[model samples]
Target: MYAAFRDTVSMREVFDSCSGVTDVVSWNTVLGGYVKCGDIGNARMMFEEMPQRNGVSWSAMVGAYAGSGELDVAREMLDEMPAVGRNIVTWNSMITGFARHGLLPLARKMFDEMPVRNLVSWNTMIRGYAVNGEMDGARKLFDVMPEKDVISWTCMISGYAQAGRYTETLELFREMQSESSARPNEVTMVSVLSACAHLTALEEGRWAHTYIDKHKMVLDNDFNLGAALVDMYAKCGKTDMAVKIFHSLDQKNVSAWNALITGLAVNGDVQDCIDVFEQMKRSGEKPNDVTFVGVLTACAHSGLVDEGRRCFQSMSSSNCGVQPEAKHYGCMVDMLGRAGLLEEAEELIRSMPMAPDVMILGALLGACRMHKRFDVAERVQSEIIGLNTRQAGCHVLISDVYAAAGKWGEALDARRVLQKCTIRKLPGSSSSMR
Candidate 1:
């Protein structure tokens, strides 16, 4: 019954229908079912009505509250639990809950207070620190851990990758490989392949791919791994290889299609990007915001203004199943701006629900410079200034626009602003020096 509907109401009727067979264990069974489904209201009511409670009962309630992000309530329950009932599993559940919610400080405090430390306890705390970008603390704990598992290694590797420390990510993977007991799993390989992609280390990527093939690692249901492989190959200027792997994928989820579409866009295969998008739509795959970002980017790069406009409009038309995000708007602005459609671009900016970001303004300013439109140039410059953006490139672009329009005084004023910002540019070496 719990397996099918998780129907607590029916389960209660069955329990009540039984002939004087109700006990703490039976009560706990019902409570556990409620806890499992995250029905906090029912669980709370059951807890209050129970004639007697034990460690499991108390622990179930604590776990449920913690899982629901009510960490303070979970802590209160732990405090109320009888001394005999508070065991390692109960403590671990609380810590796991706090960690899962990114409440690192609370999790760490609990970790310090727990009488017994298990592998799960250590892993949970380390993962908490890693997830919250406290890699230093994670590393400190990771170094002192008595026993290490694949999860410990993977957590650190994933943390480093997420922080853009790609070199460290691969280096850690190498260390994981040298250890006899631990080997890279599907999760580990994803981070490692991502690092390879960032560095464009094709040789290393190939080696990783070979490792997967040699191990006969089944990637049938693991589209993330497959997508990572496609992304890595495409980023390394090997779109042909990416296409082959994409075709070989048995199950192409939205993410898989997104990877191929984005990869094609990055590789300058604009027509292929459009073709893949059309194919994805025809196959009943829903295009996400990221998918359209790639499609709009293709149109932008290929100067397909009409196509870009059509794609942008479809985002909110109930058919696309996506809402235009800031990045999608950025792509459209860049597209229209590049095609000398400044009025259309400005109108689009005004229509944005959210204020235009630096990228959108920059695209418009660039178009202003290209077309030598001082009127629009001054308006965009004012907006950029209103933003108080400290970006040196913005000032330089504004200066260039002013100078191109023979506004020497304004150009000098813009250069002064750039100087006031104190942004340093590296000196370029002469060809003779090289």
Candidate 2:
């Protein structure tokens, strides 16, 4: 009971009181309690003082050492263990340690040498490969696994989603549905919803939502899953459905709020996006970088110059304390440029703590074209050239700005420079369903 509660102090006191009556099990229990509490030194002392040890005792020490990242000592302990004490648990501890520390080769070596492997052993290996961005390695192992659990499927799906292979993520989910009995859990649905949002596969997203409801996966209870659903609907241009899901959630975390705000902003519902941000603040959920991005985006879309400036100022440490990142600055620049405040936009770029990226400059150049600000456009073109950016849009914008001002020679010069730079614009494409 003491061990279960992690009451190491009480367990140690009781063990010392009944020293003569204590068995190996008692000692192992105390050792495990210390290990669980992360007191490796005390655990080691407990191990050394043990009158007799068993497989559990040895495995505990090996696992503790491996977990603490002392792999060398863990190996030494494993080597010293009698054949009877060196069990699968002990071997797995080493593999888990190596895999967690990004030592995939060593983990595979240990895995290949294990005399016998369990489901956990396979899952750990696959998870290691997936997390390390080696999806091919993970997939190869996942395909041959004797049996797959929910965790096994979730790891592969999550890996594909994280790696931006959204189409494959959805494909794997479909395969899992038909081929595996393990029902998709909250985690599985989160990854699936993310894939659907990226691909704008509204039908698949709606199907996943239905599956969640059928399985009694309460959206109100699971904030992450709720947020994903909100995000999926919002991305697919179903703002009303997204709003419905967002309101249905009883527990509104920062993520859920971000999804709603960003979704509304993307859909061009500027007032609703701003209102949601205000509601988020009133609810005492601190706005994160993402939340502000959405708020600024809405402001940009509608030319809310004064509101955007105020929001940008609030991001300082004295206010909401979300230090404005490049993206925030980009939104501000875009907002100001759209309002025909080119000088103020350029000033903000210059005031940035870090070097301005190409996107920020591109916004100013585009603004220059709209306002016929040929002088500022020329200055921005020089900066773009200095950065040696390969973004074809910026060069094209420079030529357009010159052409708009009736400066034909300058426009021709801009095109000649673009040709000399050997930049090729990528063809745009769209995805559709039959």
Candidate 3:
């Protein structure tokens, strides 16, 4: 945009670079850019500063905050909207934001209270339920829709895909294909392909790939369908096919790298995950938290304690400018514990500026369980159970730890606590959450 403006005769024309693109195009781009940059603060400032706010501007801000995991901010913004009438897009934004944060009840409530709705609104709610693993709810809603469109069908299929309901997902895809009125677009194909990968249905994935190729989807295509195909192949365990598809792409983005890195990690190719991480760094593509998760998971699975720590320490570089959050800390504890450095793990947890949350302590406690350290296990049991008695597997482990030490009374007490409590484990459960 800047280059085009520079080449033009009218030097008076300003670019978004000049902070003059305050129209929907400019505001949307800037707001969306803030989201993509993970600077929700700046995004919110830009939003508040906009002189005229339209549905697009409002929707952009809502989506921006939601995308950056600021659902509360989104809800507050939604509440401030004019109540004379609600626009479907703005309502959908709130619904989607709630869904993104796993507040399915809130999303459903919004859906129920809406005066009017469109296909996107319905799709947003359905996808929300689907992503939250409430497939029954998704199906229930799906069964009652008075009308169905490609988006509605795609949302249903996506829910199944996310929930690992491949058979149902594929069946729905077949149904969609048979229906002449609904044509599956690239987004629909992405979901279907994702389902195939989840089920490891390589044969079925091949059929989908063939269809995409037959239709010349690679030429002037939707956003990175080829890369999605590569990810689908990698996940389906068709390594050669995935490589071929990946090599065929002339351009690749960080998302493409993420898919491959995470797929390799899931497949237990830890060395490959590390190699890909290095390759991505060499390619000038900075690693995000998702990238760190994949690499850290690989390290945990492969017992690369020192390597994991080294990689984690390197994250302090100003180039990436990424902070090591609770997830990163938890991964480190897991790695240290896996390598039998129980004392070191314990020390790291204790030294953290943010009080060690359940995740870090849980990792350490799990290691204690593996190593039969009754003392550490006993302390960890108290902390973890205090955080959330309803946490699955922890109560059992702590009870077993007591039982191992011949403390039958304590074991029984642990069992009773689990049986009696309906305690809710706090959400996010991170040191920073405090």
Candidate 4:
């Protein structure tokens, strides 16, 4: 009970003064209390002082070490635990710990050695593979599973979605539905809707939305699913429907608001985005860094330079309660550059707390192209090259800037550099309405 409340100090005091002699359960409880408080030293001390040790005691120590990222020690403890006493939970704990740390090979090896396997063991391995970008490995394991659950399917779908394999994500969603088992849940729907948003698969997105409605999946109750729906409709050129859904939500949170704001900004509904931002503020929803990203982006797109400046400045102000991150700074630089304020943009970049990234420099080059400022373009090009960044868009922008200024030799040189750079731009994706 004391452990549940997380009063480790008090729990310790009370345990030490208790009327009864200490038993293994009492010792384990105190160890757990220390672990909960993240006092690994005390937890270890208690573990060593315990009169007797059981699987629970050993598992607690292993988990404590694992939770603190001391995987080597956790493994040592695991090895020390009696082979007869190491249960599925203990093995799962170690596998989960290794997987969490991106030690997939070690995790897989342990997984192979486990005498018993359960759904969790299989799912953990699958998730670990998916997270480590070993989708082929995840697929291989997934195919051989004797029994599959919703989490297993969701993990694969989420993996594909995260890797930006949007088409495959939708295909898998359809496949899951066609299997007649493992019906898509709220989590699965969110992943599917995210893929639809990226692909702009309006028809498929609508079908998913229809599924949610037909299944009575409780959009009003599930903020994440509701937000994903708004995002999908907005990205699919159905901002009106997105707006309708947003207004209908009774329990909107910051994330839900951010989704709507970003969607509106991406759809080029600049005024609407700004208005919604203001509404968000008036509603007392604290705008986070993401919310400002959308606000600054909308301002940049619509050439609202003064508004962008104000928004950027507000990020540092106490009233706004958010700090400007790299993306936010990038948006601000882009806004200034687009308005033909190349000098101001460069000055802002120079004053940044951290080094300006290629995206920031590339925005300046884009501005140079519009205003035909070859000197500024040359400066930005040098900075971009110095970063050793192989962003193809940066090279392409430099070439365009030179070409627009009628510097054919420099343009050709830029193109040559682009050709020499090994990095390639990913192919752009688009989908049509059915």
Candidate 5:
């Protein structure tokens, strides 16, 4: 009972109070409790005090050492174990430890040297590769597995999705559906939906939603899946479906709220996006950086300068405490520039704590072209050139700004610079002397 609760102090008290000798099971249980609690010192002492140790005791100690990142000590313990007593569980522990610590080569070496293998062993290696962004290595091992499970499929699919290979993610999911007998779980659906969202594959995403319904995969229980579905629909220009799913969730987390809010912004339902953000705050979900991005995006879309300014200012330690990141500032600059508040936008850029990126500068330049503010455009051009950017679009915009203001020489100069930026000599070629 003491070991089950993992209350080592109480267990020790009961152990001392025992009038009779404790069995090996009792000792192993206490040892496991200490390991579970991460009290390695006490666990080691308990191991030494054990009159006789079993395979469980040794395996527990090895796992504890490996888990705590004491790989050398774990290896020593494993080697000390009698060959007959060593088990696949012990080998897996070592591999898992090495993989967790980013020691992939060592993990692969251990996996290859193992006298026997199991599903867990293969999964561990595959997961290690996937987690490290080595999807090619993971796929190689996955293709040859004697058997595949949901975990194996999820690991590969999610890996591709995370690595920004959305096309491959969907392709693999299709293969999983047709070739594998294993059913897709909530995790698999989440990745599938995420890829669908990125690719705007509304039909495919709808199928995933239908599959979820057919399987009775409760969205209320998994907010991540709920959020993914919302995102997929929103990106596909189906704000109505996204709204329905958002409202269907009995419990909405920050992620789910973010998806709905951002979706509304993308779909040009500016007012609805702002309303949902207000609703989100009233529901006591502290607005995060992403929430503000959606809000600011909505404001920018509809030229809500005052509202955008208010929302931008609220992203402070005193309010939502989300410091305005570069993107947030860029959105504000874009909004102000579009509204013909060129000076204010330039002021905001100057006030930024970090160096303004090319995108932020480009927004100001584009606005200068729109408003015929050649003076401001010239200054922005200097800043862009100062940054040594290779973006031809910014340079073209500057040339257009000059042309709009009837400064032909300056316009030609800008075009020449753009031409120079586009030209590059081949590695083995040069201009002929004559």
Candidate 6:
């Protein structure tokens, strides 16, 4: 739209043409256009110059700032508005702005201060809590709401999805249908499908498919929901079903492609994962960082070291700007380490642009355990444990190394510290696993 007028007409010229229109609707449309075109300066200018500002205008400007990732400015706009006759739209905009931006405390404050709370206001706060992993807060809000709708139910389902709480999502989704004005919508099904996918609840996922088909809601613009369905199936380790869905998708996006590729990778179907990547590129779907990670992880699991190395390198200087962070480095190192190429993995760590973190060291430690390299294991263990937010499980790793090498006294010494300090092992650590 901007391209149509950029050469002959200035934005101001086009915007001013609406001046004689004389309605909040016209002004709001112009404001939204400015935001969409990324002209924040002019948007703010037109907003401040408006003679009559309605709740829609205030909400539009607030949304513009929030949409552009300017939470502070949005909050300021909210604060400057007169507290009289402020409609639900204004309050909901402010709540949603802060919530989307991950400003939970501020969003909470806004919700508490709202004089006449409505469904949107409650829904926004609930969505915020869900996004932030404050499920209890969301639940608390859900239990206390004077009114609820399908969106509110969907919000709860999505919160459960965020926590990988598949069962809870299904439970609440059922309850939503049984009670309230909340009939499940496309968004609600998407949440349920995602949970189904994540948990490999194929039966459940299939059930959602039936529901969407029954409702005739599987239109092409619903691609966001479709992408999620593909992701869920893939992550549930169901590559064949995932591929079937991808084939059915009319306009397959990068996300849809990534989902299928990731599913193959996660399931140790390396050749198919590579095939999908090549296919996506040929079809002009640009791979994002996550796409690369999924492919690399596939290569790692299947011992395609060369492909893994190439993928990691490609993510960096190859125009992706992903620049191989610690997780990528860790994945590559783990691949090599699992292959018993400990020295090569160590060399990769040394050559890393960023310092290796606990994950990297832990990978090396696992490799040491595989090949019984106690001496190297001790050093790697210490390095990993030091990086722990708490004590981690380093002491146990060191003790295990000593035991592996038959150094009884040192092993005993390590255990003594555990008895003395009463350190509980971190759940995901090797020390706890062993």
lDDT of each: 0.86, 0.90, 0.75, 0.87, 0.90, 0.78
Compose the digit string of candidate 3's lDDT tens values, residues 118-162. Answer: 888888888898878898999899888878888789888877877
Q: Estimate each model's TM-score.
A: 0.93, 0.88, 0.65, 0.91, 0.86, 0.82
Clashing pairs in 4: none
Better-scoring candidate (TM-score), 2 or 6 = 2
Q: Candidate 1 lDDT, tens digit per residue, 93-114?
A: 8988888888788898999999
- Candidate 5 to truth, TM: 0.86
Q: What lDDT does candidate 2 reach at residue 117?
A: 96
Model 4 per-residue lDDT tens digits across residues 1-434: 54654677788787777767467888888888888788999899989988888999898888888767799999999999998778888888888888888999999999999999999999989998888778889989999998899999999999999988899899888888888498888888999999999999999999999999999887756539899999999989899999999998888888789989999999999999999999998998889999999999999989999999988888877767787777888998889988999999999999888899877887788888889998998988889899988778888778888888999999999988877887565678211100
Query: What lDDT is obtained when candidate 1 is compared to the true structure?
Result: 0.86
Instruction: Name the runs in model 3 displaced over 4 angstroms.
Output: 1-149, 159-167, 219-224, 352-359, 404-413, 419-434
Pairs that collide in candidate 3 are none
Root-mean-square deviation per candidate = 3.3, 3.8, 8.8, 3.6, 5.3, 4.1
Question: On lDDT, who's better, 1 or 6?
Answer: 1
In model 5, which range of ten residues has the least summed lDDT? Answer: 425-434
lDDT of 6 by residue, 224-300 (tens): 66777777778777777778888888888877888788888888889999999988878977788788888878887
Candidate 5 local lDDT, 223-337, one digit each (tens): 3889999999999999999999999998999999999999999899999999999899889888999999999988988999999999999889564779999999999999998
Looking at model 6, the pairs that clash are 197-232
